[model samples]
Target: MGLGRLSALDPKEPVRRYQRERPGELLHLDIKRLARFEGVGHRITGNRRGASQGLGYDFLHVAIDDATRLVRPQDRRSHAMAGLVQPAPAAC
Candidate 1:
């Protein structure tokens, strides 16, 4: 369908809107690794000689509400969440 026809149904509405009924109804969680070491790293200089062998990395833990887009970020030494606990929600 054309955009003109689509917009007519819900003017100024997003293409997709997640309906969150409650505080914990919908949430998003993710983990990402941010390189902690600085130097002529592996990718650019290549790992043929194990250039980044001793270098370590830090992990970024992130959470967000699908409804409000409120984000919480924390950095950790490791990415393993085996014993990690969920943080209490902040006051609205």
Candidate 2:
């Protein structure tokens, strides 16, 4: 059978030029702060609960490979009561 038009599937007509790229060629970085639901609460007996109380944030720095599309995330949080104030964009 003959090959059909690639444009029919993807209107963008994207190319696979970067498919064979190597790692570190492209990286993805972001912050994944902990939601309020994932926070810990205190007990009424003047004792701390299982985890920290209130909402907490964790900075999740991620890196990706342009070719393999592999992903790597890094946790940059000291306290569970902290939040990510500023977030940077991923690059390729």
Highest lDDT model number: 1
Model 1 pairs in collision = none
- Clash number for candidate 1: 0
lDDT of 2 by residue, 1-92 (tens): 33387656655656766454554545444556555554334544455646645655545655455565666555665423122222212332
- TM-score for predicted model 2 compared with the true structure: 0.39
**Cα RMSD of predicted structure 2:** 10.1
Q: How many Å off is the CA of 58 in candidate 1?
A: 0.4
The global Cα lDDT (0 to 1) of model 1 is 0.61
Give, for candidate 2, the lowest lDDT window spanning 10 residues. 80-89
Which stretches in model 1 have alpha-carbon errors above 4 Å? Answer: 1-14, 39-53, 78-85
Each candidate structure's TM-score, on Cα atoms with residue i matched to residue i, is 0.52, 0.39
lDDT values for all models: 0.61, 0.48
Angstrom error at residue 14, model 1: 9.2
The local lDDT score (0 to 100) that residue 84 gets in candidate 2 is 21
